[model samples]
Target chain A: MNEKIRHLREQMKRLNLEGMIVSNPISIRYLTNIQAEGTLLITRKENIFITYAMYMEDVNSTLTINDEVIVVDIKNISKDEFENFFLFCENVGFEEGYVTYAEYKKIYQRYKVNNLVETEGIVEKQRIIKDNIEIENIKKACEITDNCFSHLLTFIKKDMTEKQVANEIERYFKENEADGLAFETVVAFGENSSKPHWIPSDRKINSGEPILIDMGCKYNGYCSDMTRTIFLGCILEEYKPYYDAVLKNEILSLDQIKDGVVVKKATEIIDENLKRNNINLIHALGHGVGMEIHEAPIIHTNVESYFKENMVIAIEPAVYFPSNYGIRIEDTVVVTKNGCIPLTKSDKNYIVI
Target chain B: MNEKIRHLREQMKRLNLEGMIVSNPISIRYLTNIQAEGTLLITRKENIFITYAMYMEDVNSTLTINDEVIVVDIKNISKDEFENFFLFCENVGFEEGYVTYAEYKKIYQRYKVNNLVETEGIVEKQRIIKDNIEIENIKKACEITDNCFSHLLTFIKKDMTEKQVANEIERYFKENEADGLAFETVVAFGENSSKPHWIPSDRKINSGEPILIDMGCKYNGYCSDMTRTIFLGCILEEYKPYYDAVLKNEILSLDQIKDGVVVKKATEIIDENLKRNNINLIHALGHGVGMEIHEAPIIHTNVESYFKENMVIAIEPAVYFPSNYGIRIEDTVVVTKNGCIPLTKSDKNYIVI
Candidate 1:
């Protein structure tokens, strides 16, 4: 049996669930190495993967017979057979955070369980702590992302449109053996950088203005996220202090974070430091990263959570002046007992390219 | 008032809903034309868009004072203020097909309405019929896709990996001013073409083997989908008949589709013809395409829906021999009063690259 599934079963036992339905494709991929369209069912006796005929061939090629997970084709199985898979189960669990109410009603009718309970993101909580293999994959993804950023430093020139720069970053990831982009590359020049989630446009990059490139890549199903605000030719005099304050507070927040530290406290430390410099950390300080770009334990003023060891997180500290320019410095890091070590090893010093 | 929101409000009135919460980003984009992170709330008297401070700038730039939707920064709003937005509403509506159970619970607690009724995809149903602007956007997207296919005929060669071919297709789309790909490009060589959703791999193409390229592009938020199967040198003797039958049925299915025709009847006609040739139509014959690559009014044997005027859909006919090879012909079309007009004008005749 897979260790992750076994751990999930133990959690299920605590909840008194006789069966659990995992429908989220990300969770399905995390549990089973089968990266295909399928739903995983953990009944009282066995683990079955239900997929259509089109995916059976790929699933067979991916999983061996020795694997404990049983593959069942939905096309081959009758409706009665599917319903009977959980006939005796008294308590069933579903991912309420993922499944819609319509799908929930469908599962309730199909399984005919006495009690359909919410898992309350048990699988997501389990995924917060990165295992050795996951850490390795994330490290590889970060390394590739770092390399791509370094290449962009040399490739990005004055008067180039943000879209062209974003396209080149994506092309670099593909050529450098990344699975693909983790999310859309955000390339905002000058005032456009004020919007944290600004989509790259056809605006030309000019000298003496801030250019923010927030990008990441995926490798082996794991994701890496990082952001850096770079100056094209020279940093503006008025923006220099803002960039310095952001960088200083970014390092300060990094120093405050460690295993067992409250997430809110760490974020507040950064928020307060920026406040002293007349800057506001508008967004969350950081977020856990794994197969998904944004995941568990959001580090913000309101979230009351503690840092855990081996959890990979992207720490982004940004200060926006609103319609003028914004500065953000980010890095992906892994939590240790005492502190977190940065997985993204790119230089964070002021770069005037 | 915005026309889309006005239409939604009229539907809400019939459902006895005083307010509606729209969380799906696609639906939000369709209604507000603001492509940012937020939730759209349609109350009894006004439309409000709640987003974070970071996105307020982008949201403001996208929408104007003349727009009916009022942008509210979530940070500035108090918890009581948010809850009061729907305080007086007797009945609230939610997208049961899109919102998760957790989100449903949150809405229930916050709104404090007498009844939280399921909308049953009222917004999506309204989105099915393409307006003049949407049709224009889809047509432009299809034009780019057709041009990309034409360019690939000259670019693809023997010994080229499937990933390379897919990458070149993507590059062509970007260079030709497309926003991005509608979905991941599927490029399969030889036997790999048997799977409908095969991910592009590093498998090298060889002479005399068929290559299947299913790709689409997004232009101005609308999507266009198209698929073409080409031979590198010559079609195999065993695969020739399968290709010819798929092509013939594809055109037949296209001819059968028109405004006011039942979707299933159109699909069944092609299915019966392919059945006579000892071929099975494994997947849905086609699907509506607009803002999304796959949308409403699925054309399959089970769907009991009628084609509507101005509805853009992708008509695809595929025949797959397990572990052997497959051929698929697809095009995006707009339903007319008498017949459907093809938006994708790429040549579907057999091509020997």
Candidate 2:
């Protein structure tokens, strides 16, 4: 069996769960490496994947004998077979976070298990600390992202539309061996940058205005996220202090991220620094990045948790002035024993394009 | 109140629900035109949208006095306030398909309502029939998609990779005033086309091979989906029959799409025709396309439903030969009283580039 599945089984045993149904595609991929539309069943003695006929070939091609996964086509499976998969199991687990209420009812009727319990995010918690191969893929994705940012510095020009700039970044990532974008590229120019989750519009870049580009790409199923706020021609005098404070806080936050560091404490430090500058941290300080751009160990003042080594996360510090402009600097980094190693090595200093 | 919300309230009356929670963002956008992270509550006397502080500005800006949606910051609302949102209501409806089991529990505890009943997809079923504005947006999107296909014919070269072609299509849409892709462009070269949902890879195009491109784009929150399988140089003798049969069935299926036409009958006709050619239809014939690429009134043999007027749908007929190549032709159309009007008008005739 794969190391991930073995680890998952151990966790299942600890939870007293005799069987589990992993329906979230990301979790399925994490366990079996089968990127198909299917439901993964972890019974007492078997790891089975049920999919439609269309995906059977892809699932078969992705799995091997060592994976210990049996692929069954949904068209060929009978209701009795589904009910019998976990026949003698005492308790079955389901992803409460992903499974819809209606689906919960349907699964209850179909599986006919004694008790269907929430898995308590057992797979997701395990995913917080990525394996070695996961780190390598994320590192490669970050390298490509940095290169794309470099290309954008030269490609971006005054009067160019934000959508155009966003498109170019996507094209650059695709041409540079990226699987795809981790999320939609956010290219906010001038006053539009004030919104934390601004969608790229036809707003044109103007001289002496801030341009925030929050972008990421996927490489080998791992994700890399980075955001850089730059100036079109020259930085405005009033914006200089805000940019300096944001950069300072970003660095302070990254410096505090290490093994055994409290997630909330690190975020509090950044929040305090921002507060000193008369700015508030609007969103979470950052979030863990892996197969999904946003995952476990959310760096927020409300999350009571600790950072663990091998966990890759994005740390972003920002200052947003409503209807004016925003300055945010972010980087994807890997948590280390002492500190954290920044994977996205883009220049944070003020740059005039 | 907006027509969409008014229609929803009427449906709520029929379901014997006094209050409802609309958590799906797409449904919320359809009702209030607010494209932000929020939960919409349809109370007896008010339309309330509760969102986080970050989305307050965007949501407020998108909504107006006529939208009648009162935006509230989640931070300002207390637990008691949450419990009062659906107060004095005997039954409150929820989107069972969208809300997860955990969220269902959370809402149940928070709302403090007498009964939480499924809305039975009241909003989604209403969305099946596109309004005038929605149809206009879908038509515009389809126009751009057709133009994109035209551009690809001239731009695609012998050695261009599948990813390159997919990127170019995306760039074309972005440059031409698209809201972005409705879904990821599926570009399969030669043998890769056998898989219906093949992700574009590094596979390069070759002479005398099939190039299947299934692409779409969003315009004004509406979607357009189309697929075309073209020959790079020449259609092989064995593949011509499959292409011709798929094209014939695609047209036959589209011709049968009209107001009040039985959905299952339309799909059954296509299936029977494909069976005569010794080919099996592996997937649904098509799906309704509006705000989402795939929506209600799924064109399948199992669905006991009827096509309604102004319902936008995609009719796709395909033939796949595993380990070889596949041919599929699709188009988005609007069902009318007598027949259907094709939105995507890309030529189905075999083209050798």
Candidate 3:
């Protein structure tokens, strides 16, 4: 957290601003170890965590921070609070992209404030590269994730619904060793597999339909994301080609994920790979996988961001048939000088089991 | 949703509000069935939903609303757009609790508006009572939760870490027929259970210690919450008194949960019971549970809200021994005219498997 605070302070120096208003809860949590749904007002001079709820006890018990962290309660928020805080800054920078017009009024009118600038994505930009601890946690999370999936394969039967499979995965995560799931387990079977963000349903896994499972686990606050699609029964010889295409594309993207490469180029390779197989690829090529599943340096074949060394990202090569089925192969990876290391260790080969 | 809207309209009438501005995402989702992170401006003359993101597409796919849900892009928000929509509203009400000061400024300044009044708990009031469908979903969610816990009991072992057990419960929910767990799976072992909201850790379960597991499942869109603390090994005679105190408190609360009893009174009963036993309870008795794990009509001894029939509330009787050990038993229940229907069926038995 101290390191994060230092990073923000350096950002303030670069922007020639005295302070920044961090409203995004995720960013606040990452920076302060406080996970409450609240806003953070940070400046070069001081930092105040504001909340309407009484979080004092929670802060004292759970949130360990340096003396630099100050807790503030919203009680008739006075203009003096903003001015006193902002006086240290030449300009007040806000995460403008996340805040709304209504939010602006409360701060400006109530505080009689002025000189606010939009400085979005700076924290996220820094978050793209994982620290050693963060990477280790991610790896541990992935290890738990892989073990859970392996157990699921053994526990799963044909009679179970997609929801059941999802639940089993969740239970396995807890039983194996995971703080919790990084996100909602996506267990889509047959037609449901077509929806990229399909919520698990009660529909049972049938004999001939394709099943796609996208899941992640959080270990020590870091997260790992992985996705694998398989068929309940014997895979048709024709579908194997598409499966092979996705696997090859994922491996190809992993091989290409070295330092100093444009993110677009990697996505383009996967895109061309899918196109070669005449599959309609949907969604982005991949995304950064860390404390947050989808972070920065997005691999979309057109993003301006470039892959840098030590940046952990997911490479998901998918082919969707809206009314029929969808197949996606995703693996979390850390960008290296030469290539990348896959975080999740699931055998992506078309499993007959 | 119509009933909810009508209920809120009646609240508006009572509060002398002609319209309301709901910026809280949960409130908006509850009112319109539009699961979009945006604002919903409700007036007698006009209703509008505004957002900067392409939530319209998401809403269209996710929700089936009766009224014509308006879509407002952030780029097009002007004074005319804000004022014209609320032209007929003599007193426009706003969710002051949720609308941040900064957002308030952006709206007030951009719209050149000054007529909106702070409307407190208008939508929250309607969300208290459980409808038939909501109750139905809650029941299914609870059933799934119960089944998951039962499966968990079958596989209980001494050496498994808290993380692994937590993972198993989550997986069970997804596989059995659930959207996901309602909240983080709390699998606190032994002394770790001392923290009421303990994050699952990599601690091994030891014999003779209380294994406290608080977990829930989300089915459909509704949620179920339940908690059970059990002796992992042999029962300690010294701990039986503490265990019995918590158990008796829950049973008494359940017996008293009839139509028209003040919810706070029920909470006070437990507090008094614990006090009589020389125990100082630190947290609230329970809370209203539904679409959200914690909702309106909090079961806190200090609160003034009364219990009503058909309200789904969580009854949690917990005894926290700070820094040493703790035990809590919680179950989601629906208050009935005669008594209450227990939604969660996870056995809160004192004995271990």
**Separate clash counts for every candidate:** 0, 0, 57
Docking class of 2: high
Model 1, docking class: high
Residues A1-353, model 2: lDDT tens digits: 99999999999999999999999999999998898898999999999999988778779999978899999999888899989999999999999999999999999998999999999899999999998999999999999999999999999988899988987888788788898799988999989999888888888988999999999999989999999999988989999999999998888877888999888887888788899999888789999999999999899999888999999999999999888999999999999988889999999999999
Q: Which segments of candidate 2 are over 4 A away from where they belong?
A: B237-241
Q: What fraction of the native interface does candidate 2 get right in terms of contacts?
A: 0.97
Q: Which residue runs of candidate 3 sit more than 4 Å off their true CA positions?
A: A20-25, A32-119, A139-178, A201-211, A229-280, A305-307, A336-353, B13-25, B32-119, B139-179, B187-189, B200-213, B228-273, B329-331, B334-353
Ranking by lDDT, best first?
Answer: 2, 1, 3
lDDT against the true structure, per candidate, is 0.89, 0.92, 0.79
RMSD of each: 2.4, 2.1, 5.8
Over the stretch A233-335, how does candidate 1's per-residue lDDT look in tens digits? 8987888888889888877777789999988888888888889999877778889999999999798989888998999999998888778888999999999
* Best of the candidates, lDDT: 2
**For every candidate, what share of the true interface contacts is present?**
0.83, 0.97, 0.13
- Give model 1's DockQ, 2 decimals: 0.82
Q: What is the TM-score of each predicted model, taking all chains together? A: 0.94, 0.95, 0.75
Give lDDT: candidate 3, residue A155. 73
Q: Give the higher-DockQ candidate: 1 or 3.
A: 1
